[model samples]
Target: MAQVSLRRLVKKYEGDVQAVKGIDLEIADHEFVVLVGPSGCGKSTTLRMIAGLEDITDGEIAIGGVVVNDIPPRDRDIAMVFQNYALYPHMTVFENMAFGLTLRRFPKDEIRRRVDNAARILDIGELLDRKPKALSGGQRQRVAMGRAIVRDPKVFLFDEPLSNLDAKLRVQMRTEIKKVHQTVKTTTVYVTHDQVEAMTLADRVVVMNNGIIEQVGPPQELYHNPTTKFVAGFIGSPAMNFIPARLENGAGALRLHLPEGIVLPVPPERTKRYAPHAGQEVLFGLRPEHLTEEKPTDKANIATFQVRPEVIEPMGMETLVHFWLQGTEVSARLDPAVPAEVGRPLTLAADMNRMHLIDPRTERVL
Candidate 1:
């Protein structure tokens, strides 16, 4: 196992298009760090630079305390798993897993021992005689992983390896991959655009935007305490609701002025934090789960409001209520026991203690 470090790393194209801005990051030994962002956000470029697949325009990359700026990919002591499941059609599972060892000309008995061990760990011993054409997608993916496992490299890199499977298979493979990581405990760097995958698999998730690192933290930390409006909207499942509101001083207290002459009071704990911008417009953020049908027990930090839902979707366990708030659409997750009807008013409670206030001009959390 090894720790990877990137200091002021940069990647620029021929047209002067900067893919990755100068970013510094550290990955500890045996840590599972995930680089997550949308396409064109430079996540893949950063992974490629670490894998020695792309040339760095500036700065340095070190693995296990050694600088590898001029090293070739084969000499990096890393194994990569791709989304396409790069396997040979003519080679059997045993041959595919043992090919790397065969190239190094290990003894026949040693090659058999390594391949057998990896096959047993992956539970693919029964499929050793079968070729890639005869195996299922999930089985082929496991074979690809087994090939990497046999190499016993210092680092493991995954480039969206679960993108090709069906939804059910993707979930199953996710659990399998987690189990493999726990057993092997090798340093891993994963890149994916799916936020759910990043949240579930990563020890620390790095949120990137426009070739820049926005935030890096544990999954729950980013979800509950986002530093920017982009992260507040990106990490959650249904995403956070953003409503335009102005802060005002009301009866020696701070309150938010919403549309339709509605006012919501700020909690006492947050009064000192938001008192400086009493007369300025700010974006109010609240998660869908925080808006519920049940009344909050803490009356001091909860506010009840009534609105007619524009749409109602009934999920198995919970219902989703959609309504308009000052021309902006907002969604609320409510109990299925409470009947939600379209064009009919329903009372909902907002937990003010968990709310977020963001600056409208800079889009930064306040």
Candidate 2:
């Protein structure tokens, strides 16, 4: 296992189109770092650069403390797993997994030992004799991974390896991959557009936007303490709600004045940090989970408000209540036991401690 470092990495295409802006990242040995962003956000391009599949327009890449700016991909000591399971149909799983070793002319005993060990780790030993066409999608993916594992390369690069699987299969494979990482502890760099995958698997998630790094942190850190509005809005399911509002100093205390005469007091603990922005038009950011049906609890900073739900969706464990505050739509999560009806006023509690204030002009979370 080896650490990888990218120093001021840059990638530009024809017409001076910059796919990846100059960015610096240091990945520790045996760490799983995920590059996550929307389409055209340069995550894939960055991964290809690290894999030596794409030429760098500027800066340098180092693996195991050696600069690989001009190193051929074959000599980079890296293995890549792509979205499509590129397996040979005519070759059995064993043969496919052992192909790389065979080409390198390893001893026959060593090849068999490595292939058997990888198959056991992947739990696909029984399917080793079967051809690619006879295996399931997940099984074929395992074979591809086994092929990489048998090489024992310095780094592992995965480019949306789970994108081709069904949702249920994707979840299963995710666990499998995590298990493999735990067992092998190979330094890994994964690129995917799915935030869920990034949150679940990454030791650190790199959130990219417009070819720039917006934020990089552990999953929970980015979720609860996003420094930028883009990170706050992009890291959660159903997305965090951003409502145009003004932070007013009401009687020496700061309060958020939202649309439709909805006013929420800023928690006492946050007043000091947000005082300078008082009376400024800022975005009120809150996640759906933070807004829920009024419940009895000892939790501090709880505030309640009334709103007539416009749309109610019944998920199995919880119900989602959506309402319109002036022209802006807001959603809240409630218990399934509560009978929430459209056009009926329902009291919901907001955990003020979890709320965020974002500057409208710079889009920074204050």
Give the alpha-carbon lDDT of every model: 0.91, 0.93
Model 2 lDDT per residue over 34-145, tens place: 9999999999999999899999999899999999999988888898888998898889999999888888899999999999999999999999999999999999899989
Candidate 1: list runs displaced more than 4 Å: 296-300
Q: How many clashes in candidate 1?
A: 0
Name the lDDT value of residue 310 in candidate 1.
99
Best by TM-score: 2
Residues 171-226, model 1: lDDT tens digits: 99888888889999999999988899999999999998888888999889999999
TM-score of each candidate structure, all chains considered together: 0.96, 0.98
lDDT for 128 in candidate 2 is: 92
List clashing residue pairs in candidate 2: 247-279
